[model samples]
Target: MDFLSTYKGGLLVISHDLPLLDESITSVLAVEHGTLEPFRGNYSYFLAERERRREQRIRERKHQDEKIARLEEGIRRFKGKTEKMAKRARSWETRVEKLKAQRTEISRRGRQVAVRFPQPPPSGRTPIKAQGLAKAFGQNVVFVDVDVDIDRGERMIIMGLNGAGKTTLLRILAGVEHADIGEVELGHQVSLGYYAQEHEQIRAGDSVLDHMRTVSALPDRELRSILGHFLLADKVDQDAGTLSGGEKTKLALAQVAVGAHNVLLLDEPTNNLDPQAKEALLDALEQYEGTLILVSHDTDFVEELAPDRAILMPDGATAYFDESMLDLVALA
Candidate 1:
């Protein structure tokens, strides 16, 4: 923000950080209905003006709807009554058609998923522990000598750059990929749930409904109700491979919810989610009582999670989380 504020050049920053937008931006260019509309102020000002415009559009739509209704009624009452009456009715019908063609649709708010994780069964005080975990892919060594322990209900975030082995570390811990050396040990009665950013857990041949059923034994009615909350009720029968990126993300989360796992390993869980869905996921995670170890590039998400500890990759350094670590989280 300081750099952007001082730079004497035009800048385009794409971010969801409200504070950053408020502090750094002079104007906002919003994409609405496939067009970029400029608002000459910060994010807050832009939001207020956008809401005002939306309300005005809605009022106009209502007025147009009433006019169209009256025109249709006039046409129905006059048609086939007499030649002149029929001609007047035709004119009214033409006017109605024109108005309908020119009518503007009211902008719709983005849909938000009602995400809720199932209550996980009780687990031991320390649900997960790693001792000198190491991983290397051929010539490239990602991380080595990493040791960490996760207590019950603790939230931990793994931070690093793009190739900093964040995802690799998560995969190793989840047992999706084997570490080159060392091991990740699970405590007693720990049910683990892994959410992969690549959607590797979702089988291509299975339907969304089938995936949910594989994770849980919930009845059809209950399962469908849960799917409805994630806006997947209509797509239950669709092949999981055919779903959009966002749809796949939602399905993966749905699988996690049904698993009732006490330990969650999430790798870039916020990837491909729109603003509303991201908020929904964040809200759900905030309420979750399970042990969480996550890899995320979204600083806002990490901030909201309020992780108690952080594991930095490459060198595999573990440290208590503080505001200073947020800079590395942002870079991640």
Candidate 2:
């Protein structure tokens, strides 16, 4: 945000950071219904103006609809009554046609996924424990001597800038990648659900419905219903590899929802999700009773989750979540 604020050039920024949007952006180019509408101001101003335009368009549509209704009624009453009445009705029909041609389209808001995680079975007091965990790729050391413990039903967030080993640490904990020097231990009866930022858990050539079936034993009818909630019902037969970024994210989350895992390791889960989908995910997380370890750059999401503790990356330092760390969360 600091760099963008100072640079005097046209910068196309795509971000969910409210602070950055309110402070740094001079204008907003909102893409809706396959068209770009430019608003000249900060984020707040753009929201207000957009709302005003939508309301105005809605009113116009209502008035036009009423006029069309009345015209149709006249056409029905006058047709076949008399030659003069029929001629007048034909004129009214022509007027209705012209009105319909000139009618303004009222934009509809985008649909959001209604996500709900299955109730996870009870687990031990400590869901996960990492001791002296360290990882490196060749000469680049990601983190070392890291120690962290996730208590039952606790929400923890990992904060760090890019390349600061946040994703690497999550992968290690998820058992997708190994730590060079230490280990992650799961408590008794603890099941893990991992959401990879790159969607690595989803296999190529597999249909979206097939992927859901692999993680869940729900009947086909029930599974299809859950997929419908995530807007994946129509894409059930589509190959997972061919999905768009947002579709893939939704599919991955759908898998997580049906897994009934007591511990969730989410790495940048909000990526590729639109604002509405993000809100839905946040609401679902708020109601979740299982332990959570999240790696995300969305400050609003982090604040709303109200993580009990934070794991600072690379150094592997641990600290309680506080307002002061919000800036670092943005950087992450």
Best by TM-score: 2
Q: What tens digits encode model 1's per-residue C-alpha lDDT throughout 199-288?
A: 997889889899989988999888898999998989999999999888899999989888889988998888777678889999999999
For candidate 1, the TM-score is 0.78
Query: lDDT per residue, candidate 2, 86-191, as tens digits?
Result: 9999999999999999998976787678989877997999989989998889999888899989899999999999999999998888888999998889899999
Once superposed on the true structure, which residue ranges of model 1 sit more than 4 Å away at CA? 1-49, 62-108
**Quality of model 1 by C-alpha lDDT:** 0.88
- Candidate 2 wrong stretches, greater than 4 Å: 13-20
In the predicted model 2, the residue pairs found to clash are none
